[model samples]
Target chain A: MIMIILFVFLCHAVTFCQIEFVKVPMQKKRPIHLALYQIKLPLPGVVSILHRASGLLLFLTLPLLLLMLENSLHSAQTYASLVALFKHPLARLSMLGLLWALLLHLCAGLRYLAIDMHLLNNLKQARESSKAVLMASFLLMLLIGVRLW
Target chain B: MVSRVVVGAHYGLRDWLIQRVTAGVMALGCLSLAIYLALHPGLDYQGWRALFSGDAVRTFALLFMLCLYYHAWIGVRDIAMDYIKPVWLRLLIHVFVILTLIVYAIWSVQILWGY
Candidate 1:
């Protein structure tokens, strides 16, 4: 087992070293590394990416959310017990995180809605919508955070 | 060609109708939820139960759940179209989501019905 482990480690290290070794092309070629720092992604791009990310998070975290809701609704005693459980710091933080995720997701959904309504079809409108999403998400997080606190 | 056009028209109309209907459903549900939250103000275990157990509340809550699932499904479908590459994998993912949503809707109904 030790010998096999050592062999695997050596092979991995060799591959890692090769990856780190950047090949400098003599000619411009296809100019693959075009102006490395010149490109700037817009707010809409960032918001679009975060919308998908938050959606994934919500999807993966859904089972826990459903469990909590079910537990809280089972009976008066179970509901009280669940509420008490949420008094812990970890639970509070988790709930706050969930709220944050939800706020972002809702903001993104609103952006989609605006697009669907043809309210933000142009470049300028799209940019403004993206800014609105960010601002709205921040404001929501603040309100919810205060409430949670 | 005529058959293809007829089937295409059917799907297009169906999807368009569903999108509009679900959008309206979610809007109403969300508006009611907002009003409920604003009016109630505080949260207590018994109060929460009483609040949800009423017939009007139960019906609205069921609509809310349905709208939520519908909206979520449409959103996920868009994401799958944007990201999922292989047609077979996309179909599998869509089937899984449909099954899960059906189960969740049934479970929610059962709970809401006091069963």
Candidate 2:
């Protein structure tokens, strides 16, 4: 937990430092700074970024998920065994991560669907809607965690 | 420009339709299971074994698994396509998901048949 937080903070620090540099004449031309922070990236933008991040995490975590599902369905004995394994500390932690991933994926996927349907298009509404989706995802994940343990 | 937009919307509409249809099937299966379990709250291991031994229940269970797995696969694929950007990585992920789904389907069949 602390390690994850520190890693995130370290990442932000590195990114900030890289972006806050004094321009030095280099032998080669530097890539153009394309970050939109200078223009005040809004709440909707943050939600969009997180949507993509969560999706990528889900993609990377697919193998473990498939194995879990497969093992559960292998037989009655395997199913019972696997469910019992879920009582372990690491399993509980992973389940917590899964709950968060599921909530985020649902929230962001619903937002994408709304956008596809041409709803929530206005700037203010987009920001407000994204904020609402993010809050819902957080609350849903919290509920899942409480229910699990 | 117009053609490209039309093609995009076409695929979007198809995806939307498939997703909704699959969701409906999954909902029905889940509701049936929930109601059945609620009605038979005291079912023991042998009782469940006997119940699942019937053709109707076995077929229902198989179809339920298939629909559920397919729906989840579609959802996962859409999520991946939305996020993963690198061409090679995305392709690899997609292939891996497909393989996993295939393996899961086979496992589901085996479980349903008590193998």
Best by DockQ: 1
Q: What is candidate 2's lDDT per residue for B1-115, written digit by digit as tens?
A: 4433111123557766776666566557655765776688666545666776788887987776676566566666766566776767767776877787787778666766753
- TM-score (chain A only) for the predictions, listed in order: 0.71, 0.66
Clash pairs detected, candidate 1: none
Residues B25-103 of candidate 1: C-alpha lDDT, one tens digit per residue: 7667756766777687777777777777789878887887787677667667767867777777877888888789888
lDDT of 1 by residue, A10-109 (tens): 9999888766554434343445656748977789999988887887777667667766767767787778788799889999887888777777877777
User: Interface RMSD for each candidate model?
Assistant: 2.6, 4.8
- The lDDT for every candidate, in the order shown, is 0.74, 0.69
- Tens-place lDDT digits, model 2, residues A1-149: 99999999999998887665544544246777778867676888888777666655665575576566556545577667876898898999977876676577567767766887899779888988888988898897787577556
Stretches of model 2 off by over 4 angstroms after superposition: A1-41, A59-63, A69-80, A117-119, B1-12, B19-97
Docking class of 1: incorrect
| Cα misplacement distance, residue A50 of candidate 2 (Å) | 3.4
TM-score of candidate 2 on Cα atoms, chains taken together: 0.57
